[model samples]
Target chain A: MFGTYLRRELLGRRRQTIIIAIGMALAIALVIIVNSVATGVRDAQAQVLRSVYGVGTDITITRPVTPPSGTDQGGQGARGPRFDFGAGAGDASGDGSRTVHSSRLTVGFGTQTMAATSLTTVQKVHGVEAASAVLSLTNTTFDGTLPSFGSRQQGGAGATPAPSGGSDAKGGSSFDVDSFTVMGMTPGGRAVGPLSATTLAKGRTLAASDEGKHVAVLDSSYAKSKSIGVGDTLSIGGTDFTVVGTVSPTGSDSATASNVYIPLDVAQKLSSQTGKVSTIYVQAESASAVDSLKASLQKALPKATVATQADLAANVSGSLGSAGQLVSNLGTWLSVIVLAAAFLIAILFTISGVTRRTREFGTLKAIGWSNRRVVGQVAGESVLQGLVGGIAGIAIGLIGVLVVNVVSPTLTGGLSSGRGVAGSMAEGARRTFGGGTGQTGRFGGAFGGASSGARSAAATQVDLSAPVTAWVIALAVALAVLGGLLAGAIGGWRASRLRPAEALRSVQ
Target chain B: MYRLKNVTKRYDAKGRTVTALNDVTLEIPDGQLVAIQGPTGGGKSTLLQMLGALDRPTSGTVELGDASLGTLADSRLTGIRGTEIGFVFQGFNLIPTLTALENVETALVPLGVSADERRDRAARALESVGLGDRGDHRPAELSGGQQQRVAIARALVKEPNVLLADEPTGNLDEDTRDEIMDLLEGLWRDRGLTLVIVTHDSAVARRAQRRLHIKAGKVKELA
Candidate 1:
């Protein structure tokens, strides 16, 4: 009887049911769209970071290159590759010009060097699964032509000799300086360093046997720029090293740790910093172990800087970060306001329907229907209306999610750490894990649930996408049902308060 | 089988007490066809309400068999109304959303009857009211006289001992009114029900075996 009566009422009073359902549907759709978009943005930021930080890097350790005070650098530190030229350094040509060539490798400007023993200390730290150290260096080559003053004087009639051993006596001088970044690693195949997030593009990767062999691997982008390939020779600090292979970052927008990669021992020797490393990447055994390990690592290496992925996330700047803030603030409030309004609409409609049916309910009570039965019937109708709305809302919300994915907007995120690890993961996450490969997901357009997010030294441009999951859909349905139940309860209470005699009397 | 002594029902309409039933004492025996006729604003409908156990009189002893109608709890009164009394309102008062059959089924719903049994009995009640073929038609789809028949069927479906009709044929034409009266008379006679009808129409009152007149909350026997 309850089912039949409820169905008939809903079908008979079609307008009320449709109106309530539509209100709920709109609220549900908005909720779905907002939540999915927020998740997508987070995923994009993570992808950017993964390109630079490598997949499993839970912590990064570095120190700043503090310059000596009271110098001409004026407290800001050294500007760049400062070169020293000695007299008679270049060869003189017939054109009265002197050509000079020199190259030097030094620690990168922003980062400091730590002892090689620190890597072992990090490895010994409790909860540390793996650790890798890198030496970041800038190789600058100075090649120039110097002017000769003596040549012009010697060409003049009755000219006297002006200089004894100056290579630029003829006085025709011009010079060119070139620079590129270089990183050195141990070839231990650890899952916590720059190589972990890269794929070998050609030839072979560096092996432990290449420790002091003067072998080098170029970043694919850097190699493309230099037009150098496998078995080619590139000069670093005046020494020609054999290029064994080339590798590229796994993430589309991520950059390699440096322009050139080489064995740590060789990089240390070439840079004249033999016992030092500029950066360390550490992986903890589990997510729960990261905080304690970070504290331990900080205690063990007092001068070194330590940062976790979560901490790095705060350094992300630009529209991606703004989107996250917007989602948490405006989007949440909008959803709440709309949902409350929808519930109010449903409740009002239900109560009014009960009012309109006063005669009918009075007649039922006169014919022996109990108050409980009448209230149940009214509530049943309301709940059914809500369930209908819930179903329609799910369909509509999914369509909204689809639209967002199809239009996949792009957001730029940059980390502000001193090392320029600029791919700060800013906005969305569902594909929050990191690995060496990625594929766009179907339901959410999320890229690589197992691979994305971390910052290198450059900001990354990433596409935002929403995720579609069973739990999210279930949550929508639950919300719809809850809204319906609330409306029904209020309406039923009104119905329950109706006295059969007064209700019937009011009809006239 | 029913008795009322000094029954007084008062209603506070806008801060002043208006007496709906004032010092009314009456006795209605089993299987009697009683008609109560009165002018507007009289105690005729209030008398019917007291008889039907729909309310508690302020100062009265109303009884049906051994049960005291005036002092029973609301739930107990409701139970008695469900099992022993039936009501037919003047407006037909059919649930507009339901068909004639579903309207009749409502009376049995409170009886805890099985679904199939309720359907079977509701259909039979409609048949007895000459509306078996019209069982599937909603109240709005039926004529004025037909809607009243559905209401009658709904009230009688549970086989109550007392049948109360309040201005049942008030909205019908003369011909339909006579037809509905004949149907009610026949059913009362066949089932030996204690039938009570409140009406203003002289024609409807004239057909009843017993007649009473109420004016200004006072009741007087009518010849």
Candidate 2:
């Protein structure tokens, strides 16, 4: 009997029911899209940080130096040699005179602040599993003629094809010298940060036996700049070294930052800094021992700066972190506002619909239906509508996510953190976990190529890759049903309170 | 059976009190065809509402069988109305959305009868009212005479002990009115169900076994 009444009432006025349901669906979809994107970017950031910081290495110790006045600690206007060591590689630029700015060149080895001797003392600290020091040699100019066999690189004046009608620096006619970084790492070095050995793009990483070979493993950024690849000969610091391999940091913006890497001995000998390093990368035995390791490292080398993974991620996120927080908090408030409006509209529609059926309700009441039964009938109908609306909303939300991805592919995997650690962490996680690898694939067209240019753009730009969990769907459905029931209860309460005689006598 | 003692029903019309039923006393015996005649605003409908447990008197007691309606809870009154009484309105107040058979079946819904039993009983009641063949037609599709028949079937399907009619034949043509009155007379005689009919036509009231004339909220027996 109840089913009969509900079906007749709803079926008789399907247009109105559908209209209300759609309104509720749109509200739910809005909530899903906003929150999903926020969560997706945050997750991407965490992954990128993990890759940049390395899966195993947790504590990083660097030399501390006072920045120039008016410089902020978050890698802004802090341009001295010491501050540049852990910073993302700065961009290279040239004036119209074709003259390169030497000061603006990316500094790979800024001042070798941490002494090379500090590695031994750091390893002896409690809770430390292993520690190695890597030397950064920034602004090291390379010869104009290098990697002579490959196609010219893109972006810089040296690589830019000359204008067809112009007399200036025609392609291949006037070569420009560019500054690059050459990181010198110990064989199987653990201090080189999260650039895992497994993420080797081409050929092999440096081994301890290749120390004297003058062989260099160029990071993807420098490799792309010089068109250098495996088995190519590249001249650095007036010395021609064979490019044995090319490596890119897993999911890191640093992939485009670090220029070249060579054996620590070669870098030490070339830079004339045989016993010094800029930074020391430390691996703790376990996650629980990270704080103790940092404290110990600080006590042992009081002048050196020690940081944990969280600190690195936060520093890397910088502005992105602030934006992410805004989006997250705003999403909650927006959902609340939209939900309240939806509920209000739903309640109004229900009251109107019930009021229109006063005659029918009077008839039913007069026919001996108790007030409880009448209320139950109304609530049942509303809950059914809510379930249907919730399902439609989920579909709409998923479609919204896909549409966003299609319209702006750059939003997929474009987030980067301060030191490119977010990108690095994402890349590293992609390799180690295999799940986030799909997310990085979205960066293929974003950077204009699959493996061309600087994928480091992806290091700072996060993408939406968080899977829509069951909990999100469940929450949406529950809210929809609750909204409908609330409206139904109010309408039913009013309907049930009408006296049958009065209701029957009332005008339609 | 119904007993009313000094029953008075009042209402506020604007700022002043208006009496719908004024200090009325009446007793209605079982198995009797009673007709109530009154002019407009004479409270015949109010009296019928009180007898059907659809309204309570402002003062005094109205009893049906052994239960005093004035003291009973609203729910109990609703139960009594569902099981012991049936009402037919002047406008043939059939739900327009329902077919004749469905209209009749609704009377059994609140009685907790199973679907099959309700359907069978509603079908029999419609057949008894001569609307069995018109069961599938909605009220809007039926003629005035046919709609009234469907309304009668709805009231009779519950097998109530008392049937109350408020100007049941008022909207019908003369011939249809005579047909409806004949049907009501046959049901009262054959089924022994008590009948209370309110009417303004003296010709309709002449056929009843007893007649009550109401004037300005007061009732008197006409010999």
Candidate 3:
């Protein structure tokens, strides 16, 4: 009997059911789209991490130094020597190092440089498949005489004065300018680090033969800024060095911020700090060896901070944790709020509908229909509406995700690791996905060299697209139906309270 | 079959209490046709409601058989109405969405009757009321008299022990009113069902076995 009544009532007044269903569907759809985007971001982060931090690479070691006083950590306007961002590093205090026996020389000032020769010791450790060293020269200027990179107004001035009195113990010299970094890479280091051959934009990687040569490979963005190309000459530290090639790193490739890459031997000779590297990246032979290797590296370089890929990811994500969490859970919280509104509207509409049909309910009551039966009839109608609404909501959510992917621009934002990590990560992604050299080509011609600001901004630009999944669809549909049923129950209870005599007697 | 003792029904209209029925005592035997004649708002409908268990008196007990209806639960009263009584109204209150046959079957809904049995009984009831051929038609498609007959079929399909009619012919012309009255008379005589009717016409009252008149919320026998 209730089923019969429910079918008849819905058929007779379809508009009301449709209106309520649509409201619920809208709420559910919003939830689905938000969750999908959140999931997509998380997945992209993992991919970029694997690319920048080599596959199977377990432990990264670096020193944390306090930024020079008066220098903006934001890195804007700081003419720093660009270092190829190595694996993300950690903090150390007070040159915490203890000498331990090793086959080759191992030196550490923990707060500054480690022995460039430490690579052999790290490689000698069990479970270590490979090891590489990096020497980053910060606050470097282009001899302060060549056209300033990215200025585009060639031969503008003689030399900009270097900042006074900040010393890097490893470089053993004061930087002339704080605009770019020069990263010194070991012969085969490019093959394993963030800015590897795979990520080179327009140049060949530095070779073992280039160790004594003053040839440098500029980062694509830095090359564009200086209007330097392959075979071009760049003056560094008062010596003319021929440009070998330009490289671009994307998606957490922190090293790509380096204005130029030169042989470790050349950098050591120029900086007057022979046989010293600032960071070391180590790869464990197997996944199972990663934990033990991290533990051993920490013990090996007690003063230097050692981190695994997971730890590095945690640090990067920690910087943006609040923002990511806000974005990820925004869907759930928004859905709850909208569902409340939808439920209220649905209930109000149902109550109003029941009120209009008071006489019909009264007639049923007078014909000996129990209040429970009346309630059942009302509830049955509502549940059916909920089911319809849930399905529609899932469809709407899927469509919304598709539309967003089609219409929205790539989203870009810097990580706390600053421009280096962002640039390298972006470059890595470009290479991994086989991105065209449209940007690189434009850098060579129309755009000439992207300004430092444009390049930094480009490094942070990441593609944003939602990846919908079965779980999101199922959850959204379930919520929509539940919301509808709850609204229906309220309406049914109100309808059941109507009295036969009074309802029939009412004028309207 | 029906008894009312000192029945008083009051309504709160805005602020004042309006006495719809005041201190009324009434009795009617089974298988008898009783006409209650009164002007509008003379408690005629209120008295009919009391006997049908559609309402409870504010002060007094309404008894159907030996049980005081005021002592029974609302659900029980609903059951009593389904199995023991039927009602016909002047408006011919047929559910507009349902066909004539469905409208008739609606009375059997609370009885837990099987669908086949309910349908068969409804069809027979429609036939008894001279609407067998009009079973599939909606109330809107039928004439006013035909609609009234559908309502009658609905009321009779339950096979109740008592039938209550409140202004059964109030909306009909003289010819249609006579036709309905004759049908009611036949049912009362042939089926031996207690019939209680509220009417405004003295001539309609003349056809009943007994007549009661009411004015200003009080009733008096017209013998």
Candidate 4:
């Protein structure tokens, strides 16, 4: 009897029922899209970690008690003078004893020189596999004096000096400004680190032959912005260099900010730092070896802080974590809006259905049907509607995700590519079918690929998973059903409470 | 068997008290058709509603069988209505969305009857009301007289002890009204069921075994 009642109600009110179903489907689709995007971002982040950073560094080393005195640190306090090499080296106390600590070492180069080089000795230490050197240089300008059409004209130069402390007369022309961090890599460093030569969007990568040839690679973003490209000549620190390549933008702090890459030997020679170095990077043979290697390095170089690849990646990725969280929070707000809309639509449909069926309920109650039976009939109809709507909504939402992937592949990590499609689809299927078993397998695949590729194409190997899409779909359906049931209950209650005689009478 | 002792029903509207039924004492015996004859606003419907367990008297003891209607919980009253009391209203009260047979079978649903039994019983009840071939027809498909017959079948399918009808033929023309009256009389006589009908029509009141005239919320025996 309940089934019969449900069938009659739905068939009789086909238009209303379809409207409710479509409302639910749209809500579910919105939820699916939001969840899929979040999942994609998370996957991409993990991929970046594995492919570029190699399980990331275990620890980071910095001046343990360096006062927060730099403008970059958001501090306004007076800073100690820029690292003074000569002033700090021979300081002695009054009792004829050296005051400087053995662990503290300072070295400097003139405006025409590079800073330091102690990395090879660090690599020779036990448990160290390879090492790379890094230098932090600011306020240095590249000379692109040759007129390029892309250069923007600054307001006619006044007698005022440039903010970079360089005089306009000294090739500080508006077109000559290029500044970024520079790091030197060894063969082993190239194999163990996240930096990749293939990420070059334009020119050839740095080679052994280019070491003494005064060649450099520019980041793609900077190259595009500055209208510079491969084969372009740039003069840095009174020396000329040819732009051999343009690297793809990492969109990360390091990549977005980096403007050039030159051979470590050439950089050293140009900077006049024959035997001094800045920082040394040591790569462990495997993830498990990180701890032992750290211990051994700590024992050998008691003064130098030993950091693993994991530690560096964490530091770099940490800077972006909060921004990602903000995006996720916005997505959550959107989901709430979608859910609230769904609930309101369900309620409206239910009320309309109940109001239209007022006479029917009155008749049923009049003919010896108990209120319980009436409520059951109504609720059963709602549940059936909800089930149909939920299933249909899920299907529609999946199609929506597919549409988004097709229309804007770059927005979804280029997943529309043949390789990306195969990988993502397989991952999506694995998640759908593998249930609990798939999590580990999927993570292993993503993590393994990331780790192996981190040193080669660090920027392109982001992890891509689709579990969030499934979860969102599930949540959307559950909410729809819940909303439906509640609407049905309210409608049924109202119907059952009506005075049968009053309901039968037509209002004047 | 039903009895109402000192049953008084009152409504409060905007600080004004109107009595629909005031201190009415009545006893309705089993296997008899009783008509409540009253003009509009004379509390006829109120009395019928109280008897049907659809309303509570403001102050009274309404005893139906061994249970006091005044003391029964809402759910318990519903159960009583489902099992022992059936109602037919003036407008026929047929669910427009359901076929005549489906509307008749609705009463049996609360009885936990099997689908087959419900269908068979509904068909039989409709046949008794001369609507056997019209089982598949909805209320809109039937005439005023036929719709009333369907309503009568729906009320009778439960085989209740008391059948209550409020202006059951009020909406019908004289011809349809007479037809509905005959159907109700036949069902009442065939089942030996107690029937309480509230009607303003003297023709309807004349068919009942006994009649009570309601005046200003008070009941008096007319015959």
List per-prediction Cα lDDT, in the order shown: 0.77, 0.68, 0.68, 0.60
Please write out the lDDT profile of model 3 over residues A336-365, one tens digit for every residue. Answer: 788888778788887887887777777788
Model 1 has fnat of 0.59
* Order of the predicted models by TM-score, top scorer first: 1, 2, 3, 4
Candidate 1 second chain TM? 0.98
DockQ of each: 0.57, 0.36, 0.39, 0.36
User: What tens digits encode model 3's per-residue C-alpha lDDT throughout B1-223?
Assistant: 7888998999899999989889998888899899999888888878877888888889988999987887799989989878888888887778777789988989999999999998899999999999889988988899888988898888888888899887888888899999999999999899999998888877789999999998778989999
Can you tell me the DockQ of model 4? Answer: 0.36
User: For this target, which candidate reaches the highest TM-score against the unseen true structure?
Assistant: 1
TM-score of chain A of 4: 0.46
Q: Highest lDDT, which number?
A: 1
Model 2: per-residue lDDT, tens digit, A188-222?
66443645432788898888798767898777654
The RMSD (Cα, Å) of candidate 1 is: 8.1
- lDDT tens per residue, model 1, B72-164: 988888899899999888888888888999989988998999999999999999999998899899999999999999989988999999999
User: Candidate 3: where is the Cα deviation over 4 Å?
Assistant: A45-67, A70-79, A82-341, A405-409, A416-455, A460-463, A506-508
Best by DockQ: 1
DockQ of 2: 0.36
lDDT of 4 by residue, A115-142 (tens): 2334545567666555555432221332
Candidate 2 docking band: acceptable
Better of 2 and 4 by TM-score: 2
Off by over 4 Å in 4: A45-335, A366-370, A411-468, A496-508
